[model samples]
Target: MAFLLFLLCLILVIFTVTTMGVPNIPSLDPVNRFLKGQTDVSKIVSSDFQEFFYDQTLDHFNYRPESYTTFQQRYYINYKWWGGASNNAPIFAYLGAESPIDDALWSIGFLPENAPRFNALLVYMEHRFYGQSNPVGSMEAPNMVDAMEKSLENPDTRGYFNSAQALADYAELLLYLKNQLQAHNSPIIVIGGSYGGMLASWFRLKYPHIALGALASSAPILYFENLTPPDGYYSVVTQDFKEASQNCYTTIKQSWDVIDQLATTPSGLAYLSQKFQTCSPLSNADELKNYLKSVYSNAAQYDAPPNYPTARICQGIDGASDATDILDRIFAGVVAYMPGMSCYVTSPEVVSPSESVSQTSIGWEWQTCSELLIPLGITSEDSMFQSLPYDANVFIDNCVRSFGVGPRPHWVTTYYGGQDIKLILSKFGSNIIFSNGLRDPYSIGGVLENISENIVAIKTTEGSHCLDILSSGEADPEWLVKQRKDEANIIDRWFAEYYRNFRLL
Candidate 1:
């Protein structure tokens, strides 16, 4: 009884709710997600891009008087590697996603590293309602926790935060920059990873006049419209652990039932909670399951080389002695991520599907409820997660209840033409590069084959989200090194073609 009493006290005293904590922040892409709340922006080994603001239309499609209100949109530009408009050096625009543009400036290693070679002007535009570009008066204030919660909860402020509005912002921004710099002849290559990658590809498709090509990394554009199998995402995650060790995979697969069984009684719940070092004693099994799912999802997303997360987790699980229970071994895996968390935060703040990826989950949650409806589930025994079917009713109910907004399920596929993507893009698309790594859960929905001569697809068996865009070093696997080289060569050809055509004129 004394030991149990001690454990309960430890749970209460050890953790306080950290709204901006590492686990609570959500991200649009794996790169941002992996580095969320963890990286010091100034200390990151990245080149600088000067910050600027532009007056942006509140609602590009709405002509109402209220819609004409202008907001200060934040953006960044770098001229260090720019070859002058007279020489026609290309321009590279990286569209920001759900997170602050500041995160991308330091994390996206591709643009700065390759800029000098292409003599490119680097630009990054912040998405509306995120970071300093927000229409909310206090969006950039130090007290962002309260500001984000209030803004995200109000649907009125979120009404204009959709893809079409954002794309138009980029379209106008790019043209304005071109005019300002007098680089009309310069070919524009829009580069993006993850959600931004989708924007880059869609930008090329919708507004070909603006950008010459797109380099989309790990962009699961096909995740919508039943274009890819529903089980694809979970399958890859299960496969990652299974590949790491069958014992690890089987242990995870069994731990769910064990958790459920344990939560059935008070003593059992207390024991479970004390064992896992929960922020509070377990009342039910929901929070525990949610935390595990997040850990697995993120581990699979950013499973890069040099002490990969999955390996670290599997080592903890598989290394346990026979005297230890399966739950202890599983808790060991959790400890791999929360090495110092005496009381794990299993609240919705940390493990809620939406909040798990962003510092503020409101904008992204709305986006998912609005248009980015990519349904993922784990049904087959092939996966380590629970048998949750992709039920639209459940998802819709959850979205409407949470955000007072409902999702447009079929809208994206109907608009984007995903039914026969190869044929659709083959005839119309050119110079776009779709880079996918099969290990990435999102890559199952990615373009993995060449659609046409110039509409290229680059795949690597050993890569994950934005591997090609990550900073290169001697420690990089040969496949990744070659992937970036090939991407550079392809971009070089694009510039050569543009310069050659301009010279003819």
Candidate 2:
């Protein structure tokens, strides 16, 4: 799917940590592209950008026999607005998250909408180990067996999937392209949202020469290594509803106990199954609880736009008749959030438009187990969900069980410098715009303040998830309009600085 005319934000950004430190939460189903306001992407043929594949090194940090191997990495390049190598136009590259990057060419609206003004060239790099970039094989490959999930299951092929390798892939590809196109003077600005946003920020931090700056929208760089509160994520989820209405918040907070009591007897379970429209008979409260958790948290995570005074979820609850039971009203909220569903299947749980192409991949699960150890959980004490804070022992056990390896929980901060963020960035980091919507749960771990004159944070209260980087709709709030405009201005300034510094060189 392609062609771009400032389309609506096509993908939501999700980096959620699953329960009990386990991974395998499914991503937003491809069948539900409409979940993110995309209506008919099937017919949107490629026009502005063309897909290309590069032979990328399998392992960048090793010299083993496997290191010599290469995989074809997919990328999209849109040159319609490029000023060409002679003019040294900025190249905007969106670092792929844990996703099939096929959709991202038109999925994100930021680059296309703003490219014409700067005469910028837009490039979207698919992350290694995901989608068609899979080192071992791809879904498109004939005899797809022993490929993708099957390939990752093989320890020999799986070890190469890591942040370092993926970032190196981006750097090498961009460097090669620059040389090939003779764009030695053009500055490369990396862009990403959510986990890809983390990669964007880390890319700038690690390879300043390669990436001039980064637009890290909703990047939770400090979520690891105890940089933020353990309960910060779910607390924000709770606050979103509490701000909506006290009754709605209380009903959600009390939902667990009600679900527990109802799950005890077969009669209760039958009633529960019928009420939530569960496809199967209720066996335990776990699935139902998880369903509710996903519903509320996702609603809060993607909670944005036009649903003023209260979100649609809250409206469902608050507008319900006083005679309605709490559970019925809760179901009303679920219906509002996910309309037109025949029934709710709690096993895999329902992934919303809010749960984007991040997470849920075997590669990402392995990353979480190995290095991207995002310690996320909720507690009924403060949050609306049950107590489930990060348990090191449990997380380690899960990691060991799944990947036959344990997580380097502190490696991210130790490698990226999160312990003393403001001080570290002030002294060394520059030209990185860390943008967030306070409504986003990930924003709790984001840089919300100016770290330095050049390394800055741009945020808005009304925004949610990757709102600032998405398409600017006519219904876009003044804050969102200003955010995109402001980001463009800052990017313009960064380009100027890069050109000035290059001239000095």
Candidate 3:
């Protein structure tokens, strides 16, 4: 699994528990409350925004040409007519990530900013099996166990939720939109960040005719074998903290030792539970370690504009009295992040038998188990934390137990042409902008250099994962402001070329 994507699931799970106020149930309708009409959507999005539900084929790759399952895929559209409404206006579409589409629309300001400039109708397409889009059934379930069982009970349904299939869904939706708006000549520009970025780039590869180009920000497309080193992800995480405050990094490493030493005795475990204010008792020492790792990983991954939580966390560590107190403050910060919520899960059964597991982990776990499976773990030398081997067998065992399917680790690389990716892009890809931040842990697994005249890569200095595409105003760092501007310029150029080529034809 891409550690960054895993962390996002973790964050969303916590967000749902703390803020969303969603009751535990077999199925949930997260969008109906917000989906009334254009007038209602205007309150959630901008005044011109309109919420929609388009029926999409459940399995785009289904061999049977005549029959298929269909679900009403949720999407939002804003035809603001920035440069006057016309069939020729391009479409700026967001390929939603593992998170909710509405969240992404609200959080990512770049899309809204650039849509008008391109004379584009803005669209945010929710990924199937996530957010309001549910293929097999509703997203909410009685529990994780039930969800897993139901997801894999029908092997055919399990086959439908992958990157390749999702790209096809995007293409189908684009065609549907073209027909609905009578904009067959309108060009489309796909935009995404993180896993969404990966989809955007792949969409260009698989369906270039549908999408003129893609703005893929901080996309870790090269995380597969023969493309990136296994240790690269965690090493970058360590560097982010070390850059902020080396003393804080050393303290975190030392605190792991303290945590391990304390976990040996029941009294020590009780003390930890009391100090950290864990939702449950400290039963599994390894789970505690995983929770701690997530703290650092989350801080580092989201260490960007608005509030630099990573820097604040490091400052807290530096300002603490001693090593033990340092650990206490760090845990306190985690608790503070989710105030008045029992967000941490103690049991192994619910959380996929690993510290990295979450309530939403099963959905992502199945994908990693089926494809896009990448090994990422902590180590003593490569990372600032204590050594912990990435147990591939454990992941396989859990996958088998949960989904009755084991991971095909090389499937993504094999299917997508791993190391030959550069060549693939050069020969076939164009009008794609791959943007990455130097501070981002996942940047190494992305396109850091320009591959060709059209397939461009923009690396940001002092920027975190997908920072350039995230919501930013005057408060953003100087570098990020400039990076966003550069990205916009490149996207404009791609649209220009697309129009030029279209006119020529």
Candidate 4:
């Protein structure tokens, strides 16, 4: 009884010390500063382009406009004329996604490569609630915690962060830039990849007056439930590997069973930890499975030609009898995504886990919890993994816990008209290009066919997601090079038509 009492007291002391103490304030990390209410924009600088902020309205839908807040949204521009921004020139703008605007500008291929041909001004706009554009206002104000607490505590401020509001920001920013440059006639071509791609398409659909056209690559505009194939994402992942090597796919599919068995015993779990080089022991079956599955899904998504992971993954999996050897080879192949990272840690808390390759910004998570919920599940029937059905209830429960609000389940589909998306887009004019790679899982939900002469889908063989939009090189595939050339020609025609009609109007 005495020994038991002393043990209990010791456990209590450790728990109290760890949990009840004053919360350790995070150090001066960039991400931590953003989260901890440090919104000083002076420190966030970029050498590639001049950064500016536009004072944007909080809500465009509200008729009583006096009852809202306005905040500065960060954007970047590079004006060193490519071919010289002569009188009749176009503006190449990227409708930034849930990421830093500068990063997107530097990484995308089309704008840098083709902007010079049209003497276009390069502009990149950061999305709301992301990067330096927190809509609730500056975090660097005095009494930082109180300001953050007040914003969170307020009811009106909580629900203003959504896609519709973001499009309005883009429209306002577009007019601001055009007026500032004194080039109202210049045709504006908006470019984006992934979620940004979705925005690019929707922007052309909603506000065609401001945006002349859009280049939306890997944009899964039809990914909502009752619209896309339930197994589309995972099945495409399996197909990428199966095309690489059937034996590899078979080995990968069977390995999940082995992992499940290994998770059952202490010795087995320890072995998996050592073999996979996981930072810690496996905590549960689901976490281990998810980490394992992400390895293949990421490889499929980024599998461009020449340097992509298909050849490498197959080379590792072929004729490999030992399960440990197979896993090691697979892990080694996928680590190409993370260059400096040493070991694979399943815990998301780690700086760069294997799953971090697929991780998005914190703002994206909030958006998913608030409105955007695209379900990704895996099953042996659909992909090269054990059966794991997606549970919509699990998603709702998680969102409820995370955001303290339930998902507006069908708001996106209802507002946008999901099933009627193709028909709705048909009513619009041309200047919208939907580019997708066959290997890309998202392609399954994207626009794959030509709607009209103006609106068209350009499909690439053996191409991964958004390859047309990424940074290009001499090493790029012949198909991609041809595709970029075709896209540029289309844009040139669009600009010509826009200027021709503008003169008449």
Q: What's the TM for model 2?
A: 0.90
* Predictions in order: lDDT: 0.75, 0.74, 0.67, 0.65
Query: lDDT per residue, candidate 4, 1-505, as tens digits?
Result: 3222111111000000011111111110101111111111223223658889998888888866653668878988877663333475788888877655644654565787787788888888987765667665555533323333444445466567778888889999998888887777778899887778888888887888888899988888787777875567888889998988888787777777777787798787777777767767756555555655555665666666664556566765563446466566555544433334556645633323322211123344556666676665554474787665666677677667656777776877877655776676677556799999888777888889998888999998777677787666666668989999988988989988887897898
Better of 1 and 3 by lDDT: 1
How well does model 4 score by local distance difference test?
A: 0.65
Q: Which ten residues in a row have the lowest lDDT in candidate 1?
A: 7-16
Better of 1 and 4 by lDDT: 1
Ranking by lDDT: 1, 2, 3, 4
Question: For candidate 3, lDDT tens digit of each residue in 161-264?
Answer: 78887888899999888888778888888988877898888888788889988999888888875677666777887988888887777777777777878888
Give the TM-score comparing model 4 with the true structure, all chains together.
0.83
TM-scores for all predictions: 0.90, 0.90, 0.85, 0.83
Flag the better candidate by TM-score, 2 or 4.
2
**What global local distance difference test value does model 3 have?**
0.67
**Which candidate do you rate higher for TM-score, 3 or 4?**
3
* Residue-level lDDT for 261 in candidate 3: 84
Residue pairs with colliding backbones in model 1 are 25-357, 25-358, 25-359, 26-357, 26-358, 26-359, 27-357, 27-358
